[model samples]
Target: MGKIKKRLKNFKAPDALLLICILMAMVSILTYLIPAGEYTRFLDPETGKEMVDPNSFHYIENTPVGPWKVLSSVHQGLVESAGITSFLFIIGGAFGVLNSTGALEALISRTATRLKGKEKLVVIFFVTLWALGGAFLGNFEECLAFLPMQITLCLALGFDSITGVVIGICGVAVGYIGGVMNPFTLGISQQIAQLPPYSGIGFRLVLWLATLTVTIVYIYRYADKIHKNPQLSLSYEVDKASKYREEISSNIEFSIRHKLVLISFVLAVIGIVYGVIVFQFYLGEMAAVFILLTIVMACISDKPVNETVNAFVNGAADLLYPCLCVGFARGLTIIMMEGHILDVIVHSLTGVLGKLPSIVSAPLSFIVISIINLFVPSGSGKAVIVMPILVPMADVLGITRQTVALAYHMGDGITNLLSPAEATIMVALGLMKISYGKWIKWFWKLVLLWYLIGIIACIIAVNIGFGPF
Candidate 1:
């Protein structure tokens, strides 16, 4: 008894990778316990997206997964990650090349220097912009461009990397959750459900404001805490090097070459925004743009071609862990699908909604999408998979599709800040050198608060009949 008690007392939280592995194991075990089931899926002729038929769920026999298959899912996840993983590497390498040329440091230092006295204002300003970008544009990967500057800016402002993570990553995440005019989640879901495009903008804007205000307050409190006592930061032990970052930024003179390089970098970001909005390009095209910018930056900075290549490789290598985490975490979904248990879970949850009161079930839709997001992280993709079923279901229950959209946004959007399968969260934590556990330690409370607020918002929406109907 003493031995067991001592072991429990001394137990350490598993590292991120280990936690993923354990979750995978637990999921594999569940395949045997939960009967394998599925819903009928058909290709939507109009949108060309596959969608599930809610009424078609039924169990199949003898679909238990073996240890070997479960283990192999890790590799399968990597294979599935070719698009996202490659995008991360390319972006990391692009930033790496810029860093090698001293241009990156110059850019950050200039901003930090300019914002010296208005540090808190700087945070609020960028947080608002990032939130707006996320709300309106559904900008996730495109926002990675600002991370280098944001991190250095945090160091210069006398806060640790946590603040930077909050500003850069959390800022956009909250905006994405707002989904007011976001094309990917709200827009796509509305279109597929045959609703007017951008319907519910007023409601969503209100959501954005409420959520963003809370988010700003949440982040500001933490920023103020670290400012008062740096030791209070989640990344404090790792923050000693912050001064070195400051020193590096401090000494650089922002030379003419650096200025030109900075201009080129700015053009690259503009080009990215254009590509996303106009061209509607994705991973491969975006990666190509970064590559082009990298080569251009290296040449203008007078870096030797071979040395530039090495630097890019090294930079991408640093980010490989998070990219790999993305794939590894995806293995959980692959295992669930392979065992045919994914549909069972979805069906079970959605089916339960019919039994509860509209007030109760309406808000619980947020939880529904939140649970689904763990298995499927892509917002547009999730919209395709879920909105079809949820749209019809909402009407049947005398609830509005707009409210379901809100629930879906709250579920799929906010959870990305912590979901293992979310590339944004993984990439941010990887870049900031903060462990997944530390991020959860620092940010989970706010997420819980956000969850409560979302529930309340949903209840209010149902009560007021918030809709285009």
Candidate 2:
């Protein structure tokens, strides 16, 4: 009993995130089990009508035939989960190999060594790197590789590790939300809405820059605080610093295989840039190309081909659990839509707040999305569900779709830093040995501050005619 209690006592923030997610899933399941009216009707997208079916066990109007139909729907969830997990795994593995080969380490070391006297500048540099990486790469999971390096840089500059992780993750989260030309979410969402292909790039680009600036400034101020008073930082621990230093010093070898990986990585970047600029490949297709390139590079490195394949497979496998969790979360949305819960919630909220001006409407949009995030974590998927409703609502209130989009982005990005639904944040908290309560205690203030800034920025942008009509 004592041993169990001790173990629970030591449970970290990531564990808490996982626990919260599981609890949410349980709630979702309970909601499904409860009897609800009008859940028998499924909407026909093409006909713009809801079709009712008496049978709960059979298919009707191409929607799941009944509540029990979700059993078969699990297959669809598994397939989608597998695809996302596998992709994340491969990307994460490639990033891990790149780090193991010392490319990432070398870069971090060189940069950190040079910026010894300018800690605030270093923070800005990492914020920029992570922001651009998220915008161009469109892979949030891969930020895991860069995170430890940022923590190390922060420690080297006498700052807390939390500072680095928060800043980097926030920057990436924002970039992912404000993705300018990202094919995954933005492209797919626009396509679903029948918007012209990439027509909103100009607006997205401006929003991206504005959000990036706010993030950079926020991080710089925090970094300045740590630089001036390292002793006061919550994340500062002498033993932690010593341990990290020892690890870095022990693994400083720069092998020829690393050089090959770096060269191939450079070529892959050039190819992606060309594809985006010249061939105009969508972000998802571009990601496929980059993953292929990384696989080839891994094979060509000093590691045996079979070993490289195994490494990649192992990497991909790591993502399975989180991916499934996300899918299960999606299942809740499926259930809600079928159960008329979505309409109920949407109808209630819209009825209450549908009459506000753009300024109030914008912030309310963010709040609604943030609340929704508790149930749906996938930004792209959530956008599909929320944007259709919010956009039209915004239009009725004389707000532009772009303003609505920004609200969606802010809601999505802000909660990611604090939400248990975000698996990557859980993974990161686990890696850092930080408790969820502790991390929230440390970061919630920053998250709230950034959320306010982001909301204000969106309002300002909309007023200045930066929104898409």
- RMSD per candidate (Å) reads 2.3, 6.8
Q: List per-prediction Cα lDDT, in the order shown.
A: 0.81, 0.61
- TM value for model 1: 0.94
| Best-matching candidate per lDDT | 1
lDDT of 1 by residue, 374-402 (tens): 87788987886678778878888988887
Clashing pairs in 1: none
Which portions of model 1 show Cα errors greater than 4 Å? 1-11, 241-244, 248-251
Candidate 2 accuracy as lDDT: 0.61
The candidate scoring highest on TM-score is 1
lDDT of 2 at 361: 73
Candidate 2, residue 101: Cα displacement in angstroms equals 3.8
Give a tens-digit lDDT track for model 2, residues 35-67: 433324566476343433322222223222254
Score every model by TM-score: 0.94, 0.69
Error of 2 at 322 (Å): 5.9
